[model samples]
Target: MAGIGFELRKMMRRDTLTGVAKAYLYAGVISSGPLILSIIGMLLIGVLSLGKVIPDFLITQFQVSVTYLIAASLILTGFVQLAFTRFMSDRLFEKRIDLVLPNFNAVVLIATSMSGVIGLVLAFTLFADLSLGYRVLMITGFVILSNIWIAAIVLSSVKEYKHILGTFFIGYTVTVGAALELNRFGLEGLLLGFVIGHFVLLIGLSGLIYRNYPSDRFVSFEVFDKRFAYPSLIFVGFFYNLGVWLDKFMFWFGPGTGQQIIGPLRASAIYDIPVFISYLCVMPGMAAFLVRIEADFVEFYDEFYDAVRSGATLAHIQESRDMMVRTVRAGLYEIMKIQAVVILLIFAFGDWLLDKLGISTLYSPLLRIDVIAASLQVLFLGALNVFFYLDQRKTVFSLSFVFVLLNGVLTALTLHFGPGTYGYGFAGALLLTVIASVYLLDRKFEGLEYETYMLQKS
Candidate 1:
């Protein structure tokens, strides 16, 4: 992402209003386009299929099914996502680019097989009441989506943001179009359309990977070797992803808050709608994060490391470290400012926006709170990115663990309390987590010089 950020920074150098706007726009699209596209495409399908598809409940069923698929696949693949990212980063740092493609293939293969087995079992057993075609398409969509997540991680390393955005646009366009046409066949048709769209996405992403990083070998398991893999990263990834969705999962399964949607699956419309709507507001924060952290903070981060590696005078290294610290602080402050503006906008027009979407204004309060929570989530992500850059894996693991624990316990308490405190649990958990992360980051930087000099291979 820093590579792409460098390109965006060049755009900002044009020193014109349009140029600056374009840079942020590009960053937003590239950083959040795929997700925004997916959400829009799915919602568009539901909206357009209203009159065309018989039995309106099928649309809800399709939506619920896709939601579960996305949530489940992300959590399932979390085990490998960060570990494999670290492996690729290390291999690239070592100038072993050839290893990237093969290892990517190996990870994709493993993820596909694991998700395939799990998806098949659930689709067949849990969905016994659904039609065979629906079952097949459900599992197929799950597998494709699981692989898509892995593919996305690799594509993030590529600098061709245009191609990445184009692929997602084309893919989701197909999804909305195909789904509209397929609605005549009922739920199975909608699921099949989704499956087809993601299949295209996976193929396009794979092509880009192959074109960029051509490798002699087709697959390799070197990434799984003990020396190359970080077990802490596995837990960090799992806990982080789980924490993000754990509150939602509890809401969906809680006794009174949720109702059965389809075949063992359940949903909390009161909670889910506001949460999803709030997520769309994360684009500004994400763009700021990519620009501030990747472009601005990374410049100083590199200089600090370079000074350390070149055996610069202690004074020079300290100066570089101070500069890095300042950049990090400024970057975080900028991210917060941008997201604060977004939250204010949400507060101003949240009810109007919900009415426009035909959602009850009764959800307005929850939407406002959820937007704040989502904003904090972006801040949390920025902090984690800094930690990852510094290779503070143990610190990151602790933070992630705390996030999962707090989110689960707090959400349960909210459920026990009442409806008035609904979204507070998730919001409070993120607030506390972000606060802890900031404190840890400050302490880490305070001793960074000592850690750099004393903790060394030499």
Candidate 2:
């Protein structure tokens, strides 16, 4: 991402008004490219639901089922995602790029086997009422989607932004077109189209990775070895991903908020629309995030650490530290500023936007709250990125745990309180988490010299 940021900055070397606008636009695309595609894909599905050819109710069911597949697959594969990322990153740092492709194969192999088994069992039991073909397609889609996510994570870390964006565009184009054509077969057809599209996506990403890091060996179980794996990372990944979905799940399962959309699956129409829109609105902040933390903050971060390592004069080291601290503060401030503007824009046109989307204005307040929550979510992401740079995984693990616990408990309480209080819980949890993260980051930066120079090597 920093590399992407650097490239964007280079494009804006002129710093003219049009250049600046283009730079920001490019940043937004790079920052939220994959998510933008996903949101568009989902929206396209929603649009198709309104067509007369397929029963709208069945289309709704397909939407809900696909949503469930996405959430479940992400949660189930969360542990492996982070563990493999850490393993491969360590290997790369050690200049053992040879190990990467083999371990990736191992990770994919394990993820497929695990998700395949679980998806089959769940489809058979939970979706028993659905047709046999639909269930099979659902299970296959889930497995493929899970593998795509794992591959996509690694691909994001290594591949260029343009290549990643192109792959998503092609893959989702096929998905939307295929699903539309197959709507005659109803949910089963929609599911099959989704599977085919994702399979194409997986193949494209796998090819990119192979081109970058080709290996003759087809498979390896090296990720299972204790030497490269980190158990703490496994838990961190699981908890972090679980935390992200906890509030949404609570809303979906809550008796008052949730309704059965399909066999043993549920959706919260009122809750989901606002949340998705809010997520879309946060693209600007995400773009700012990549430039601020990934590029500017990282530049100072390396300089500060490098000064220390070189045994530079105390004044030089202090200057570097101050610059690093200032850079961090400035980066966070920029994110807040950008996200603040986004929130205001959303607020100003909330009703009209909802009207344009064919949603009731009654959802305006929820949408506003969700946008604020999503804004804080980006701030939290910036903090987490900083923590990662500092190698503060334990701190990150603690924060993720708190996010999960608070989101679950608070959302449940909000549900108990009634409709008026909805969306506040998710927002409140983010607010609190951001506050704690800022405090910890401040303390860490304050003690940077001691931690870097005085503390024994871990």
Candidate 3:
């Protein structure tokens, strides 16, 4: 991501207004393109289905099913996402690029097998009432989506951003077209179309990965190699993803907030909509993160760490460390500035926008709250990225754990407290987490000189 950010900054070296605009446009697309495309594609499907050949109820069912597919797939694959990323990053660091594709393939294979079994069990038992074909399609979609997510994490690390965007466009185009064309078959058709589209996406991503790292061997289980596996990263990945989704899950099954949308599936109309919109609002902040943190902070980080490793003079090392700290501060400051503008714009025009879209005014307050929370989430991500660069696994795990636990407890309390309080729990949790992260980051940087020199002696 930082690499892409650097590339964007280089392109904007002209410093013209047009150059700046293009830089951010490219940054937004590279940083959040796939997700934005997915959201738009799904929303388009929902909108276009209205007054079309498909029945309204089936469309609703399709939306609910796809929502679960996304959530479950992300959480399931999150267990392996960062671990595999670390594995590949280590291989890259060692200049053993040849090992990357094989090990990544190994991770995908393991994830697929596990998710397949889980999907099958749930599909057959929980969805036994649905047709056999529907169950099979559901399981297939879940497995494919899971693999795609894991692949996406690794693919993003490489430099084929354009190929990824092209694949997403082609894949989702197929999805919307196929779903509309196959509406005659009901929900099963929609699900099947989704599975097919995602399979195309999987193939495209896998093909690109393979092309980049061609292997003569058919399969490799090297990701399970003890030398490569980082258990801390595995836990960090799983916990962080779980923390992000925990509040939503609680809301889904909450006493008053949720109801069954499908067999053993639930949706909270009040909670889901605002949360999704909030996530959308994070795109600008995400772009800023990639630009400022990845581009600026990382450059100094490389210099500081390299100086330490090279046995440079104490003065040089201190200078590099100071520069790194400054860069981090500037990066975080940039994110806040950009996101503040975004939030203010949304707040001012949100009601009119929602009204135009036929969304209820009831959702306006929650949208504002969620945008703040999501903005804080970007800062949290920046903090986590820095921690990872420093190999601070314990801090990452602790923060993730607290995020999940605090969000759950506070959100539950909010539910008990009543309506006006609905979105505050998520906001509060994120705010506290950000404060802690900022403090820890500052403390960690302050002690870098001591840690780099004295810790080695001790």
Candidate 4:
């Protein structure tokens, strides 16, 4: 029994790629209860209600409201959200646990307060002139739930993620089970279930974190310096991420961008839904890889830079280079494999999926372009996660700027030329990036990063 315990402890201590894979498997199971159920529940609401009680116009409005609320929150928190993870992770990385408690406490309070303000504003919006009160209420619940969900997002980025996953799984299962039982509560039940789950998840995970990582040492105020190395990366990253979806933003929100038409065909209608749905497939990948990226950052710190600077012979450098190549290659290949499977599924089942939902107008040749772009996003983000520790920010800035510039030019031209071309904006941008990256690779390797990747060395 002691032997078995020791082996388990050893396994738990390992937070490698393989370890993360194991951890993600467990987390996936727990999150599955909520993630899958959320989708199922939404589908049920649409199907079981059968559009008779709700009406299509109301449904569409509800979706728009929910979509706007979510997008606004993400955009509003864009820079801070990027900084929050690194800020928390850096403190923990440097063995300054004391800062973490205060940091987390401040965060929770701030987030809760913000949610309250948002909820109030939403109430006004829903009640001021809208007749779809019930739908409005339900969608508001989703918005508030998303705020609480942000807490989960940040905490997961901290170290000791395996145990965090365990606690969350239990709580999530409870939420899912209870949510279905109390169907009479309507979307309120969904919201209540979510709040209950977060309460459980937050408490349980907080306890595990406290027990494992006691915050006894007093950390310096410098640790909280919001202007530290990676802190500024948030702005660059915000713009870079903004650029990634800039073309889409232009399509949806930009004036006259959606007006582009080839003969009688409109580009925005065809490009919108498929691209949006393709992004959801990214959730699983992001959730699983979040902790793994941190782990890989640590590995790179100890191995890659140190060896390269140690005046090792060509043979030794070659060996290390081989490992780096393999690491990057494997990560890229795995992401590509998953993306390939997802894109194929989307392409194959897309018609049924959209038509059944009365949104069949969202398919276009742009699907392939988006698949390629999103696939590169995951793979390159993973590779760059490792390389960023080497102080390689300029290349990332340069490349991302190029991407933005190319997309900006093309999207504007498409918008102005009165041509049916939504995805052409992304195609222009990403296509330029591909050509430039290939050329750059032939001359020299290791590209740029938009995010400040390194938290700290352990």
Q: After superposition, how far is residue 404 of candidate 4 from its true place, in Å?
A: 4.7
TM-score of 4: 0.66
Model 3 residue 279 distance off true place after TM-score fit, in angstroms: 1.1
At residue 28, give the lDDT of candidate 2: 75
Off by more than 4 A, model 3? 1-6, 14-19, 456-458
Order the candidates by lDDT, highest first.
1, 2, 3, 4
Q: Pick the candidate with the highest TM-score.
A: 1
Error of 2 at 92 (Å): 1.8
Q: Estimate each model's TM-score.
A: 0.98, 0.94, 0.95, 0.66
lDDT of each: 0.88, 0.82, 0.81, 0.52
Per-residue CA lDDT of model 2 for 99-188, tens digit only, reads: 778888888888889888997888778877778898888888888888888877676455366786788778898888887778788777
C-alpha displacement of 127 in model 3, angstroms?
1.2
Which residue runs of candidate 4 sit more than 4 Å off their true CA positions? 1-53, 110-154, 157-213, 216-231, 254-271, 283-301, 305-318, 344-366, 394-409, 412-420, 427-458
Off by over 4 Å in 1: none
Using TM-score, rank the candidates from best to worst.
Answer: 1, 3, 2, 4
lDDT tens digits, residue span 1-458, model 3: 35465566676677899877767766676677555566666777777767764558777778888888887877888789888877777777787778878787788888889889998888768888877887888889888888888777777666655676788778889888887777677788777777787788889888888887777776677878887768888778877778788888888899899888778888888988888888888888888788777777778888998998899998999899899888888878888998899789879988987898889988999889988998999999999999888878889888988888888889999899987888899889988998999999999998988877787744
Clash count, predicted structure 4: 3
On residues 1-458, what C-alpha lDDT tens digit does candidate 1 reach at each position?
A: 36577777788789899988878887887778555667778888999999888889989999999988888888988999999999988887788989999999999999989988997888768788877888888788878888888888887778787787788878888888888888899988898888888888889989999998898999999999988979999989889989999999999999988999989889998899999889889998889888888877888898999999998999999999999999889888988999899899988988899999999999998999999999999899999999999999999999999999999999999999988999999999999999999999999999998888898776
lDDT of 2 at 294: 70
The residue pairs found clashing in candidate 1 are: none
